[model samples]
Structures are given as structure tokens and as C-alpha cells.
Target chain A: MVCELCAVAKKEVESELLYEDNEIMAVVHLKPAIPGQIIVFPKHHYPIFEQVPDKIIAKMFKIANKLGIALFESLNCHGTNLLINNGVAAGQTMAHFSLNLIPRKEKDGLKLQWEPKKASEEELQTAFLMINEKSKELHPDLFGREEKNEELVEERGRPKEIKLDKKKENYLLKSLKRLP
Target chain B: MPEEEYSEEERKAFEEKIKRMSPEELKEFQKRNCVFCQIIIGQIPAKKVYEDDHCLAVLEINPAAPGHILLLPKEHHAIMPQIPEEEIGHLFMAAKHLSHALLRGLKCGGINLFVANGAVAGQKFQHFVIHLIPRKESDGIKLELPQREIPEDILSKINEVVQNRFNELMGIKKELVKVETKEHAEKKKEAADEEESEKKKEETEKTDPQEEENEDEKSEESEEEKDGSISLDDIASVLNGGR
Candidate 1:
């Protein structure tokens, strides 16, 4: 079966390619939920989110963050949402995995919010126990590994230098710059 | 109770004060006002699920679904753009693992990994968080993002602007790469060169006659089965005592 996203990656489909590297690509969504919605995905076809390797997932999200910031700066959007629908039940339509970075505005008529459904204390506790137990089992290193001494040394040192260019500097300086 | 209203002059004074504050002072101020920071520091209580050096995951008090989790960075960051690349990578790695745990524990079909970066995007808090919402078929939670018909001219215009801005950001990243140690850069280049030669070897192997087609067909079939294993039909059947 031909994957639509793989076609997009190969430039077989008409997509506005926003960014590309060896492992990933970002494109303007052909049918955007919002005007500046961008879709970021791996160039290699991964059928689901869980199948992607850890390194590529990390790089994918890092690039997604950059693209989201681009939406903020270019479109003058009020905000952005990084959304992943991991499976069909979660509303994932395509077989290939991707992340949607949607530009948002106040009262934009996008209904992404859900009313809070209160679960009972007993149910909550049961979920907590089951999930916590399984999580610990799955990630033994995260739970059982001794705290590394290097982390403390790094924290005490001066923070990592994140050099911001002049444009970014202006954005950071104005607290309410994006706010109306 | 009467609502206390600030005069226009008072509001202007507050804005001016904020404008005059340095970035560090701004961060400190945001930290003080942030509730998630309090939760991270153990000043406020939370339903903690997982903790590591760089992040903390807690069960959402008001959840969209059972086993819904909020994954947060330990340090205070107001938005995604403010976070460094490495930290962003670490947080998502943790998120992936947490999603795996939810799928196994809750026996759910899927998970929604969501991040709202600003107030307009439903970011209720100042701190950064990734919401891991467990999902099953026909769960009442709705995330409706309706696709509207934008004019051709507008679409192309947006495409151009976003492309230019993304290029500018990439330029900034290139500058950051220049600061890496020479030794580290050399190591990366060496690794890339090795991988390129290995890829060339694989391409040569793929040119063989009948064996290549069979191998390709087998790999494709395996990939299909792997994808089909997580489909809703299979999960639904499992839920219906077919497991």
C-alpha cells in the first residue's frame, strides 16, 4: 500500500515543504484545521508513534517545537498546540505517524477542550496503582538508577548559554508581546 | 463581594515595571507565581506517578480519561520556544515511555500526546506540560479541529512566510552548532562517513536477482502485521473477551 506521507516526503505529492533534513520533514498541511497548521513527520515511514525509535522521536519533537515557534513569529498567532494522535482510537486517520502544530487564536472556534469528567477516588487510586506499577516495571532504569552526581555539578554551574538573536531577544523581552 | 478594579494608570505602571525587568528577574517572577513550580519543589501536593532527574509525571486531577497523566519539566519554562533542544528531547523520551505504560496498564487502545503552548491554545498554566490522555474507541472526549477552506492566495502567502521564518530559525541553530568543541564535531563527521559507506554496501546487496524481491516482500508483510497488531478491531476484540 502506498503511504500518503511517504509520497509527500518524496515530493510525489504537492506539499509546501517547510523544512527537511535527513530523517524528518515539516510541511504546511494541505487541508489545515487552522491557517498555519504544519505537519512534522519522519521521512522513514513509521506506522505508529510507538514504533519510532527514541532518537528520532526526540529529534522529531525538537523540530516540531521550532516549527511551532515559526508559526508564532510569522503568523502572529496567539499560541500553538503540539498534538499527536497515536492510534486509530485516538483519532489518527493515516497509517503513518505525524505531529500537528496548529496555530491558535482566542475564540478561533476550534473545539479542542473537553469538560472534566470526575472519576471516583477509588477508581483514581486503582488507576494510580496499576499505572505506577507498570511504569516502574517498564522503566526500571528511570526508577531504580541512583541519582547521578554529575547532574548536581551541572546544575550548580552557570546555566547553559542559549544564544538568542536580536529578533528572539525582542520577543523574550516583551512579556505581553504575543498577548493582545 | 465587589470586584476590585485597577485604574488605567495603575495598569500602565504595572506594564512599565514588567517591561523594565530583566529576563532573569522575569523568570524569577514567573517561578514565584507558577503553581507547577510549587508542585515540582514539593511545596504543593500532587498525585505523583513518576519522577526522574529532569522531569516529573503526575496523574491529572480532573482527567479527560482514566490514567491521564501530566508530564512536566522540573525547571520552570513558560512555553515550548523557551526550552532548550536537549531538554525538549528528554521530556519527549519520558513522554513516550509514559505513554507505553498507560497503554499496558489501562489496557487502552491508544494515547493522545498533547502540548498547549499558550493561553489561546488552552494552556491554563504557565509551566510547560505534555498531557498523555489514554483513549479507547468512542470515548466521549472530543478534540475537534475542523478544516476550513482557505483561499489559494492566502494559503500560498502563509506558506511563504512560515518557510522564511523557519529558515531564519535554522540559521540561528547553525550558529549554535559552531560553538561545539572541535573534537565532538570531528567525531560526528566520522560517524556520518561510516554510515554512508554502510548504506552504499546495502544498496549493492539489493541489486541481486530473485532473492531481493523475496526479502523485500517478507519485510513488507512483517511491517503490515506489526501495524495491524495495534488496530482498533484487534483491541476491541481483546476487550470483548477475545484476549
Candidate 2:
């Protein structure tokens, strides 16, 4: 199936391009969030943020910082915002992944606020404890007494499947089915 | 165009508040709503560029310019502050090279790097990403900010709540208990030796200690307290089944 970004990167669709290398492409947004807003994306289609490699992500940021500097110097904008929309819930429109770089001036009418919400002490502790526990599973090298065995590192990305004897499987299925 | 400026400290505090949400919350928030994951797994087609073991770079369908690119890690991370610190440098290094290419290739005046962390911050997608926007004279782009005033009491209350919660989560004010353990002593000795060597290297190379600390944070080891009894493990495990 044809993807819009794929078409642009492949030159199947005409675009006013800025830069292109073997692995990435930069283009001006047709309907930019702001006038000087630009969208930077990988040439290949990677629809989500979590699955992209670290090195490539680093490269993207390095480029972004440079662009940010350029915007400050050349465009005369006071600052910039590096924006990414990750999922449908976050208001991501395109199926493919992209970042929006928007130039900023003083009092330009964008309002990004973190209005505080009240939470009970119990709720606050629950939040803290959940992250505290999860951090152990996440960074064993830091919190846990034991190091992450080599076995775990080798199994980092791939999904794991559990094997059980038929009797055990049947028992498990029965128990789960009995849940109200 | 209007600029909304916050002190570095304020920005950090805001980021921390946003990141206070657990990873599970982010994961639940994503829930197969990711199109980028599909591309990585080769379920969907995209224009190919650079690919490595950890991340990928691609072009935007709706171009801000000719060479607009999006860089991201292969792993799905929705929040910016929650990303592993080590991975951050990698993303920026690639972006630096791309900026140079743009400078040489495009007829642009400058570039902008924009990131929105949450829905309130104009983040349309749940994925964590950075944008590179090129700018020129009379490009007509504007980022406007409207100022607001909060009552002193409300502001102080916000500060008290966030600060108190953050301290608890990070174990900032927990009194250090002296529990003499052989393991603790051995680790301390080893850490001292390592620090001595690191100091010597710093003397010779004049490397910034701050950068090193940032990198170490990614590995989850910190300089302050190596293995204290009042650690996250103790706090987290206690709540496991009780909640």
C-alpha cells in the first residue's frame, strides 16, 4: 500500500525538500502549525517512536539542535518547540512518524500549560510506589540487589512465549474462565 | 511570533511533573495505537533511509521543507523525560549532521527543533519525537504565547504538592541509616578506586564531569548513594500486593 511520506521520500510526490541523505529526509509542512514550522522524518516508514533505534534518534536530535540554532540566528525567532505526536490518543494525524519544529516569538498566542490537579495522599503514594517498583524491573543494575543476568539482556526486544504441560494449561484456563 | 520562556529550573520541574506518570501508564496509553511500530516490523511500507540496531530516521509525508526528517528510537517511548538519558545524545548527534546537510543543501535561513510532551502541550501523537523546522526571512511562521497570572497561594500550593511528591519518589530527604554491611563496605572501596581513576582521567583530558553523570544516569547507577536500604526497591516491593 502507498504511504504519503513514503511517496514524498521516494520522489513519487513532488515536495519542496530541504535536505536528504541515504537514510533521512526533511520537508516543509504543507499546513504548518506555524508559518516557519518544519517536519523532519526518517526516509523509511517507522510509524511509532518506541521501536526506532537509539543512534538514529540521536542523529535526528543533533540535526534538530542545529536547526534550532539556525532558526534563532537566521529566522530571528526567540526560541523553538520540538513537538512529537506519538499515537492516536496524542492526536497524531499521519500514520507515519514525524516531528514538528515550530519557531517562536514573544506573545505569539500558543498556550502550553500544566494546570495542577489535586490528588489525595493515598493516590500520591500509589503513584510513587508503582514507579518505584517498576523501576526495579526497568533498571536492575541500579535498584535491585542482583544484576540482570546475561540471559535477560539477550532476550531484551523479542517477545517471550510460555510453555506449560497440558494439564497445567487446562487448569490455568479453567481458573481464568471462572473469574467473575 | 511570541516566545514563551521559562527558566531552565522551571522547565526541568515541569518535565518531572509530566514524567511522574509510571511507564505502565504510558504503555497502556499507547496500546497498539502506534503506526511507527508497524513500519519497523515491515507491516507498512516507507521510504528507506538510515537504520541501525537502536533507531530509525524517516521523512515526513507533509513536508515542512524538502529534507524534513523525523528521528526516533526503535523502542516505543511516549514521554520525553522518561527516555533513557544515554539514548538522548545519540538522537542529537544524528540531528547535528542533518543540520549541516541542510545548511549546505537547502536555501533556508535557520532550523527549529520542536517537541511537545503531552496532549496539553500540543502533542498530537503519543510517540516521543523531535521536529526539525527550517526557517527563512519572511517565512511567516509564528509561535504565540499568552501570559497568565496565578494567585500566590495557588502557586505556592502547586509548588508544595509537586515538590513533596517528587522528594518522596526520588528519596531525596530520607535520612541515611548506617547499617554496616560487608557488601556495602566492599562496594564503597570499589567506588573510591573508580573515582580516583576517573579524577586522574579528568585531570588529563579535562572532560566535563556533568556529561559523565548524565551518561551514568542511563545505566541506573548514581554517585550519591550506591546501595542504600531506603531505595526504590524497598518502597516499590512493599506496595506490590497490598494495593
Best by DockQ: 1
C-alpha RMSD over true interface residues, model 2: 21.0
Error of 1 at B140 (Å): 1.9
In candidate 1 the C-alpha lDDT for residue A41 amounts to: 95
Candidate 1 falls in which docking quality class?
A: acceptable
The digit string of per-residue lDDT tens for model 2 on B66-116 reads 444566667788745556645566555444434333322343444445466
Could you report the DockQ of all the candidates, in the order they appear?
Answer: 0.27, 0.05
- Off by more than 4 A, model 1: A146-180, B1-26, B172-243
**lDDT, model 1, position A83:** 90
Question: Which regions of candidate 2 deviate over 4 angstroms?
Answer: A132-180, B1-243
lDDT values for all models = 0.74, 0.50
Instruction: For all candidates in order, state the fraction of native interface contacts they contain.
Output: 0.69, 0.09
Candidate 1 lDDT at B14 equals: 87
TM-score of candidate 2 on Cα atoms, chains taken together: 0.37
lDDT of 2 by residue, A6-47 (tens): 899999997545446677766555554444455678887865
Using Cα atoms with residue i matched to residue i, what is each candidate's TM-score against the true structure?
0.70, 0.37
